[model samples]
Target: MNHNLFGIIVVFAAAAAWGMSGIFVTLIIDSSGCSSVALAFWRDFTTFCVLLLYTLVTAPHRLTIQKKDILWFLAMGCCLGGFHIFYNKSVMMNGAAVTTVQQAAMPAVVTIAAWYLWKEALTREKIVAMVIIFSGTVMASGLNLFTLERINVTGLMVGFIVPFFYAGWTLCGKNIVNRYGAVPCLAIAFGIAATMLLPLQPFVTQPGFLNCKIILIFSGLIGLSTVGAFTFYMIGLKYVQAGIASILVMSEILFAGVYAWFLLNERLSFVQTIGAIFVIIGVAWLSFKKPDAASE
Candidate 1:
């Protein structure tokens, strides 16, 4: 029981750290002016080094990647990698407030995916929650939710990918964890994803890629947000109930809104506030339900 409590604490901390990543990345980009490719490469590279160092020092003997799971890991890594690149890119294009809204929309996607593809049963309460969330967010976005305004179609598409691919990652993560154990699997996946970006740094990068200061900032991302925070989350999840873990992560949206509004000087429109509220409520409902028809 104590172990479980620790895990939940880790997960909550990871959620908050993740929420801050956007604001951090935004500051980095404002200083660096690098393309998404370069920015992504450095980001993943820093994380790779952190994961690699930990694995080498602590579990050098245990770091073998199964030949079978190698391919699976690679594929998952690509999807996961793409998700990060696109999510960060979205923040670069859209402001943090909107990015937060878009991410807040993820539970809807995960629930929908689980229901339709996994055949998970959805309760009436869950459906109502989704509806309320959608209505509220639409109200928050103000200028017709579907219309192109400050957030263009390209940015919109990229922003949406954050949840879409994360939902996909969540699905893939279950299989990988079942097969290879989470730590090594996550490590391998990060390895493959990092390798996927090594070739493009020169072709797409500018002065920022070489900036020592930017490099340090990027490493801060890996250290605090990715490695340390995620480690806490993974540990916490092992002890706490998954439903509780999901609920605890609701803090990300809250954190993001506070950080953006207070630190980043971003303003949230009434519509966006409504949308954010809906997203929180919807996710709370969806994450709490038991999977019946979803995963037989």
Candidate 2:
């Protein structure tokens, strides 16, 4: 098989696994009455443990980090921690489909931030793509300025805010990822996030919180959604161009929408569906266009 084709397949599979995250989150919340914070904590903690063990076995030297890089990892971890809390909260309030569509704005956010912070080119194509992405996110959120019908204002706000933290996570890890490798950096970041959320650990001790159903959900969430998704994505990046990988990762939005519609009975409105299409088109446009030489 062609290496690029193989990478595309792996990345798509990773997206599919990530798409199931919301379903598992909803199921755990419904069955165990776990708070969003608790769920985030457990997810991070379990993923960290798994990644840590993998690092220990495969590349123990990667675990060592310079003291100077601690701050970078801390920032990355905090961004990831913030992302989890708000993302899960948004999912709880808005359901999976809407939240996932809102998350599609991440690439736009990252693009804008890069231009601002790193002097990356702010090209016409990227500007147009950002506009389309923002417009689509607003529509997908079901926020009608005229009537304000079918809108959860808080959820919409929270959902929209998710991309900022996600972008921050990406930006913060960009430099350090080269130094420490993706898995080790991610393992450390997850550990830091889990540590930050440790105060919520008591919630896990509540009656029925650790029941069989919730346990199973956690296992799937940690094993498939978190660990498996990241592992596949990192490997896929080794074989594919970053732009193509970004485009392929958009599959998560579609997969999440389908899973929500079938399993959770969450349906997107006509406008929302159109908005999702717009987001996909916009992000793909951005992915396909290369920045000018000045930016590179």
lDDT of 2 by residue, 1-296 (tens): 76666766788888899989888888887787767788788788889999999899998899888998989899988888888988888988887756766776776666666667756666687667667766766676565657856668898899988878877776666547767777888899999999998987775533254488778888889899988987677666555544345445766766777777898698999997997787678766755565366523
* Cα lDDT listed for each candidate: 0.65, 0.75
Q: What TM-score fits each model?
A: 0.78, 0.81
Model 1 Cα lDDT, one tens digit per residue, 1-296: 34544554567688878877876787788888877767677666667777777777777765676676666677767866777788778888876656656765665665565556545455576557656655654555344666566667788778888877665555455445544455655676677777887777678755364778877777777777777665565555455433344445655765666667787697888767876787677656654555334231
Report the Cα RMSD per candidate. Answer: 4.0, 3.6
Highest lDDT model number: 2
Full-model lDDT, candidate 1: 0.65
Clashes within 3 Å, all models in order: 13, 0
**What would the TM-score be for candidate 2 when compared with the true structure?**
0.81
Which regions of candidate 1 fall more than 4 Å away from where they truly are?
Answer: 2-10, 112-121, 130-147, 178-181, 206-213, 232-251, 265-296
Please report, as a residue range, the 10-residue window in candidate 2 with the lowest summed lDDT. Answer: 238-247
